[model samples]
Target chain A: MNLHHAPSSTPLVEMVDIEKHFGGIRAVNGVTLDLYPGEVVGVLGHNGAGKSCLMRILSGAMIPSKGQVRINGQDAQIHSPHDARDLGIETIYQTLALADHLDAPSNLFLGRELKTRFGSLDDGRMMREAVDVLKRLNPNFKNLSDPVSSLSGGQRQVIAIARAIYFDVKILIMDEPTAALGPSETAMVSKLIKQLRDDGIGILLVSHDMHDVFELCDRVVVMNKGKNVGSHRIEDVTKDDVLSLIIKGQLPDDWVPRSQETVQ
Target chain B: MAETDRSPPLVGWNLKLSASSFHKLSALFTLACLIIVFSFGNPAFFSINNGLTVLLQTAVIGLLGIGMTLVIITGGIDLSVGSVLALSGTVTGLCVKAGIPVAPSMAIGVCVGAACGLFNGFVITKMRITPFVATLGMMLIARGVALQLTGAAPISRLGEAFGVLGNGSLFRIIEKGANGFPKVVFPGIPYPVILLAIVAVAAAYLLNRRQIGRHIYATGSNEEAARLSGVAVDRTKMIAYTLSGALAGLSGNVLMSRLITAQPNEGVMYELDAIAAAVIGGASLMGGIGNISGTMIGAFIIGVLRNGLNMAGVSAFIQQILIGFIVILAVYIDQIRNRR
Candidate 1:
């Protein structure tokens, strides 16, 4: 087991040599990655490249077959998504997971619905809160009472992000945040990512779109076929260099995989 | 991905119409049209006597329909509800015959009904059986077991208290008639009607206000999404089926109290009527799209249709055909609405 010790500046989250296998298929091979506070790290890869698989393990949506997840320099247990959320980790899935029949506040607080003194849903208070949060994310937004199904794609994305932040997120994982969005929606998401990073949350974003990686990310981590090739500062690398790493799973001349490998 | 999650039906002139309100309005409109047509066909259909009768008759099915709405909204069906009702009535009858007190006997019957529902929930959740097949199997098994318990004979000899629970009225402002029959000075609420109203109020509050209720809707709308969000999908479905069974049991008790007997064959096909009322009220078999008030309206529609047709000299066989057609029509409308 790879244990992380405290330095007060330890990365917000560290995944040490994670491995996941499904029957004969090794979906995500041994991979190590770290997320620091107040930085946006992009995971770039082709389809089926295990970008989602790695993030899902970190989010506790799926368990790693082998690895230790250290939170704030201490080993933490993440058995389920609820546990992940309780530890101040939230994930914005590509599917967007909104209850289409529910209104904005309802979708924003789906499982963790706010309750009144009598234990009933406090819709009035929830709507008031939803209005406050949603307005800051999208200024021209007005349909707080409308069901999410009728909302535009960008509005829905805003709702998803608003949900995570409202829950007091410390580490945010976004999978393909702008994959289904138009240009305006993409820009909105990009802006939201930068704002979240500025607010001191560690963000792990998975994307295939090079524009989103360059526009919103401080650093890019490329993976191919379930293995992390390397992590690079965006300022030090060009788009083509990262593209080559993603397509060929090649390591940079000075870069090396994290020092330790887990024993079987 | 954008459209995959938006499965709730959309209607024309519906962009502003929240799906729940739209369905409620359409159901109310249908109920109104049915009432007007029936009233025109027979003037007696609009009379106070017939109205009371319709409301009273709506009690049994309406009670089951309330529970059915909850179950259906979770995207599951309880075909065993009618059989569970029969079993509960038979258990109550057996208790009374064994010298048990009337009140406790009925409570035992209701508990037994809840137990039956729990069993259904267990099979579906723990054993991983599809609800349709599990409840279908339970329907057959429960009816057969109920018949076996009673030796295929109806239990009679229930006393005066039995009559009181089923036929008693609230606010005793009545004078004894010439034959010692009670004649009311004021319109009073029947026990069954009172129970129906109380149940509907409580159910409406539970479905609309509570967290479990929200989880139910979430589970039905998208199970995987709900699970990921920390909603207990299995627990929600279990509660839905169990509540449905308990309601079916209570309806059966009220039914047996009125008849003062437990017939092994009683409550046969009652599930169909309850499901039909729920469907007519806009509860989707697909789940997550219904309300109890609309279900009550649907039950009233069924009651009016049956009473009006009978008053119009329509045969029972013809009434069955008409009901079947209405069920079909409601589903067809739902399909078109969902597609749009």
Candidate 2:
């Protein structure tokens, strides 16, 4: 298998020959990917296609059995989520994993709460930062004080994104962010993803939504049956190519397809 | 524009008022109801002396309840507090018998209590033992140790200075007698009562204003989330247990000083009383929501119920039964309010 290298760009994060196994089952085998600065890479796969597993390894939620992870050309030893955070890697899980009882500011500051002179939580500062971050991500988000439980799915996603961005995350891993959202919410998330890319954050987004991949992601990496099948630029590949990779586990060798559909 | 019109203000003045008032008013409502019931039932219930007696009696349990409130808010229970108290009192007795100074003996008692708390914390956090189970085991062990230390009997003959903690008044005043009657008035501030107040105030400040206090709530509310957020979950849990144990020890020592004896059987049912006080004060058994003030009120409620029952000629067994019912009722009320 020939590997293409984008040598002009210095990748923000690179995983070389990554291998992870759960007991006897090989979850991810010999997968290598690079996320460049200001790029959103879509990881497309079916259920149990090792997409989540690979992302988990990247986020340091789980350790890879073999292979090395390098951040900005430095070897990274990420054994836990805290270690991931130290490296500016943050993950927003499908469950969102947010504390429902806490309001936005509290959730944003969770374990690393800002403290006042008296050593209590600096609520005013946290609130101010939360507001500023939310406005930059989505100006329509106005209810910053309400408990996340009371917010709509879209609002919760916005808060989650805001949390990662405010922490100055260099690599953001989002798992099925729009899985439970409506069309309008999906659009809002798409817009947020674009904004995050513009801020030069490297994002690894795992999703089943082909439309989201085509619309928001600069490049798409297709995974099938626990292996990296191929990576394609959005400009060079069509939706049919991605779907074929996901279904047949490989791109067609010689299929000429029509091009230049109107850009929506 | 349509969406903005539909959405309510993030936080309205009325909504904030209602939320704060809801908790304050519920506590007020319960207090008012308790007063009205006791006043109507017994004419002597509201007497100054009777009130002072109730406060003195509630002080020890109130101190334990404050600690329990913190522990329970962190989603932990300390069933061993009663046993820890007995052990602490026993240690104080042994110290005095061995000719240790009264003040130092008292300090040793408190240190013993803190040791018990540290042990409980270690077992729960490092060993990953459930708080209830670990404390239950510690409770049995502490009780057995107390019994063994005292030879399963009462140890009397405490130092005079120690008695001042339980029985002696801080101040005394002479008043004029009416119609050739002689009257002597002692301020009637028991040392335990004073200590209880100090501890309660300090606990309230710690729980409500300090970063450690916030960590306790965060740990109790959602432990995994707390850890992810960088709140040391194990350390917070350890602090709660240690505080609970130390206070229990203090309560035991005070009880012994008041009675002028270390009775092995004295603290047998004290844990129930402390737990009831915490629950009655609105500290949820599920944790992450409680305060020292609420716990003090709960201790008073228990004290009043016991005092009122005695005045009304209720048997001791019946008083226990009534208290059990009240605890269930208070917890039920808390559950309903939380659901809303």
Candidate 3:
């Protein structure tokens, strides 16, 4: 992880003390996290660890039981995915959230489609734009008219990523982006994440891959049993230390604790 | 590169047809085969009069199929269409009896259907009822309402202007043959047939060229994904169901005009025919796979088959069984095509 540049500006996003409950089960306890501009923060957790729930709250898929989100130091009311999208927050869900029957251009501009002066769908223009963005991510992508269900997993992943960055996105929430990808595809995604971060976009990367966290993320946050275990700069903690945090929600005995507010 | 290797080579018309397009066209191919076979079975089946008769016969069901195609493509089934058609006709009949003008009365009838569809949409989306159960309930309710409204009576002898909507033709040309026998040059086209053509073209335009159409497909393809993607899934479904209702109402008007009467018990089992046409045209009950042109052709197939069978003196019961078998065959072929 690169540590040369400091966060000199207001953090791009501040999710403060978010809590969510499903009936008697607490899916996410009070947890707070901050992301600065041009940084990738890896959220590490096992299944049902509440990391996905926390990210979903920020993505506006679920309303937190108690908490608020601030974008650029301003509170935002994210009640639906539409609200999040308007705030330049995009999420690539673990399922990719793609309608399988539609073609590339249709999926790329699913809800927010471009229209001609006659108020009809501007399919030609959309096709061109989809192709351009898709080629940027994977140059070899071709079958532009085929239904997305016919595409390979890697290609579908590219479509999901393309959808997230196709517009003027300020923040991106990726839930297990590389969980289903192979070795070469994983490398491609890592490169894309770095590229987007370099473009000044704040990214919350939810993953279980320690190598991915160690290599790509500037900071790491771990959760266990719906509670935040710890937050650390990737350079300050070893992979095993982060793994222990994910599994047992513990920190090293000799490690000095940074104040919660100043950790970022 | 590996992905490219998995897909067929993107060269030639074969690739352009794809699996879905082929499935849609299969219906057209079947229609052609049926026409050829029927023409051979009965020479009169190949005449211009028979062709016109088939189009006239198809008008009501074609309109119903247009709406059915839209609803089915949205992954919904509207079982109340036949009942709604009867209801629309009876309502229009009551309006005519009350001395309402022809055009406004027709519009009111279509609107009534639209309102019922809107209510269905509201119940399914807001009240969280499955479309199947909701529409089945609507079927019973609409039929009962239609029967009760007219007291199980038939409204007959509507005005001359109303009769023109279903029976009138344009550009008729007849010449006196030898021995003073009248030979028909052209029968022109029935108003209902023309109406079906216009509605079908408009429907095709909406499905292929509009944003709402894409949203409808997306909603049917995957509702959760559409919601997450910012599609107003409920609104799309409402539009689909509403359109279905309006089209069914319009079909009712045409039917009433043709019979010169509106019977409370009319249009029983018509919904099944509409569904059959849509399915035979390539619309899947599972949703997100259908087209207007395919549906219209599918309607014509039914019309032609019935006319040809009648000319051959086949029993009505046998024709019914044949149509049911054809519907199953069409869906089976589509499934096989898609599985490839």
Instruction: State which docking tier applies to candidate 2.
Output: acceptable
Top candidate by TM-score = 3
Task: Indicate which candidate wins on DockQ.
Answer: 3
Give the Cα-based TM-score of candidate 1 against the true structure: 0.90
Would you list the rank order by TM-score, best first?
A: 3, 1, 2
Best by the lDDT measure:
3
Per-candidate local distance difference test: 0.84, 0.80, 0.86
Q: What is the lDDT of residue A137 in candidate 2?
A: 68
**Candidate 2 local Cα displacement, residue B251, angstroms:** 2.1
Score chain A of each prediction against the true chain A by TM-score and list the results: 0.89, 0.89, 0.93
TM-scores for every candidate against the unseen true structure: 0.90, 0.87, 0.94
What DockQ does candidate 3 have relative to the true complex? 0.52
| Pairs of residues at least 3 apart in sequence or in different chains that clash in candidate 1 | none
lDDT for B238 in candidate 1 is: 92
The runs of at least 3 residues in candidate 2 whose Cα sits more than 4 Å from the true structure, single-residue gaps closed, are A1-9, A17-31, A63-67, A135-147, A223-227, A244-249, A252-264, B1-24, B168-188
**Interface RMSD per candidate:** 5.3, 6.6, 5.2
Per-residue lDDT value at A6 in model 1: 41
Give the runs in model 1 whose Cα sits over 4 Å from its true position: A1-7, A252-264, B1-17, B40-43, B176-187, B337-340
lDDT of 1 by residue, B184-264 (tens): 665567789999999998987788788888777877777777777777789899999999999989998999998999877
